[model samples]
Target: MLNPLSLVSPPALRAALRDRLTFRAKLTAAFTALFFCAGAALLIFVTVLARQGTMEQFARITMDHTGGPTAPQPTSSTSLAPVSPPGPDRAASTPGPGPAASTEPWQKAEDARLARVEVNNRLQETAVRQMVVWSAVGLAVMAVLSGAMGWWLAGRALRPVRKVILAARRMSEENLHERLQLTGPQDELRELGDTYDTMLDRLERSFTSQRRFVANASHELRTPLAAQRTSIEVGLADPLPAHLIPVREDLLITNREAEHLIAALLLLARSDRGLDETEDTDLAELTRQAADELSSLAAERTVVTTVHTTPLSVNGDPVLLKHLASNLVRNAIQYNHPQGTVTVRIDDARRLTVTNTGPRIDPTRVDSLFEPFRRLDRDRTAVHGHGLGLSIVRSIATAHGGTVTAAPVPAGGLRIEVRLPTTR
Candidate 1:
């Protein structure tokens, strides 16, 4: 014999399986099941109650009387006493056959039995019909209501997910700054949105940094190229020997500037790549070397340079770290005034400080000191330093798991500090 359940058509079976997996379908199915079960239970209870009532009524009828019916009681004083059989034999004067045996009593008993059976059958039929019709109607109504409610509830629960999807679709690199910012009581969806927003925040910062770096690089390169082109064009225009020597000198100066700019750009790129090699090196030693390297430049500019060292070791790329130290010292010496002091200090706490007596800087411009190609008023107008000095310092320090901070000195110039984790 075939299993009745397995006899379902293929299309119907597939649809049922598909519906079972979906949230909406599952929710609706759950509601329908509950409604159906409840309705069936109520119907069964009602049917049982009705059946019990009918049985009780039949039982009452069956047990109510003594046998079928009691013998008829005397109706009045006239029939209170028996007839006395009408004087045994009233002779020939009495009716001939004494009224053939009466059959009325037997007929009445038969009629009563048939009437009871008919009433019972009619009552049962009525109850069964009513139950079938009303239960079906109630079930149909409840199924519809349950399905609608389930659909509505499911939509409400998924509303936040829809918002997240829409927001994600509208996202791009240019609009990474946009946040879901979903507001509600803490739940899984809210947590997800908050996490997504945090990720976007990180992406936006990274993009902004990259864009600024590229723009600064382009502007720095273009300025030198433009100057070089102008110098060459002017030099070629004046062919005289006297003018030619001066023009050649101008070309050399422009070429040197371009060279310095290119070197700075390359150093900046390397620093941005982060440390690819690590070694235990004394920061104090690097600081001393950097100071010695810039000592001549300092002297030529009438700036006195000094280095104070205490052995403090850190793990980082030696080249990048050396570059970091050199940039700081160079900036100090290049930006200092005549008779000014440049102090490079390496403390035992893994901190490097470079202080210089240069033109007093505006406090507001201190933060911008570490931005690529950004310089103070004097450095901006001066023909010398390209402004990647502090930026390179900051990048290298960060790559080595360190922090750099700078403050404008009250007595003129800048005080910069770099703190690195000590090698263990």
Candidate 2:
């Protein structure tokens, strides 16, 4: 017959295990259970041994009380029975009765009963010992099974985490397009993967824009540089009449274009480095100064300019701020219709708005218009600029921790607002 203890199959036992219970926990629980069981067994064994020892001592005491084979004394001397002499020939021929024959029947019966009880007690103790040994063995087997099951469960529970780790490890700049496969409900790990993918998408877009900007800037710089070189080469190759000034004009144009490109590059570099020559200046005074400086250009365009002023103090580099304000005002006047109005307003709220009557800008392209080398007019005829004027304005405003926004006026033309944080 199969032992009941060994009837538990390994696979069936393993199937009963739970997940996330680690090996150490299982070990600790098993040892604790084993320690208690061992203690209980030891206690039972000691109690049984003690009871057996006590019973043995009691049996010896009873035997001593019975005075083994010793005869009882008379209560009084007259009551004693006189000894009878045996026949002389019979005494000589037969041996006297030994002490063993003098023992009482009850004494022997009690001794035999005690021996039988002792044998039965020994059998009971043997059965108890066997039970304790088997129980302990069963507990040890359970501990081993539990430890194996716990380790397997721990591994299974950590499987998802491991997959996430592997995915993260495989991620690189070259392979940022690769994404984690989220197959389950939106748990924390899945949420984390989603966020990571979102960030990577944004980074990829930024990188694409940066690459295009670099390519466009290089093309813009190359045009003027090539023109300057050609002008210099042509002027040196031939001596022209003094009044035939087309060459001089061409050289002048080339020089201006080169200077504009260099200046734009410098501004972009400085903006990137966070280099600003800052100081506290009156914005109203700055506006007046910019209007005066641009008066000649405005007159040439036949654009009437009006300046409304309020004292607004701000902390920033005066030259850069003037450049920013001048660019906006110039862009307005340059793009305005002949005999149109260009208005500059400075308010106590530290707001500067330059509004001009001009051709309306396409709403779709408004956001990209402020990017470097992005011209609103692709033909470059309606307006003359390095396409970096508004970009520089944005850069300088950002350096001063301000913002510049351009919006079309409800009535007509464009309204460019520069908002700065005021200083008391």
Query: What TM-score should be assigned to candidate 2?
Result: 0.46
Encode model 1's per-residue lDDT on 1-424: one tens digit a residue.
Answer: 9997689988999888886686656776787788888888888888788778887777567546424544334448647654655555653556535333334565576577657766776877797778778888988897788879877887787778878889888775446878899999999989989988898898888877885686578567867677777767775665557857786777767777776777777676666656667989877788788788888898899999888889888887888888899999998888888899988888766689999997778999899989988877865448487788898898788777788999999999999999998762
lDDT of 2 by residue, 1-424 (tens): 9887478787765655634555555655665566567766776776578667756765576567555434454448537745557777755665547336545655676676667666757766776677667866766676666657765665665556667678678654335567766667778767776777787788767756664575567567767677777767686554767665676777767677776766676665455434336678887888889899999999998999999999888887787878888888887887778898999998766699999897667767677768987766643335667778888888778767788988876655788999988742
Worst 10 residues of 2 by lDDT: 66-75
TM-score of each: 0.49, 0.46
Model 1 off-target regions past 4 Å?
Answer: 1-240
Q: Estimate every model's Cα lDDT from 0 to 1.
A: 0.79, 0.72
RMSD of candidate 2 to the truth, in angstroms, is 18.8
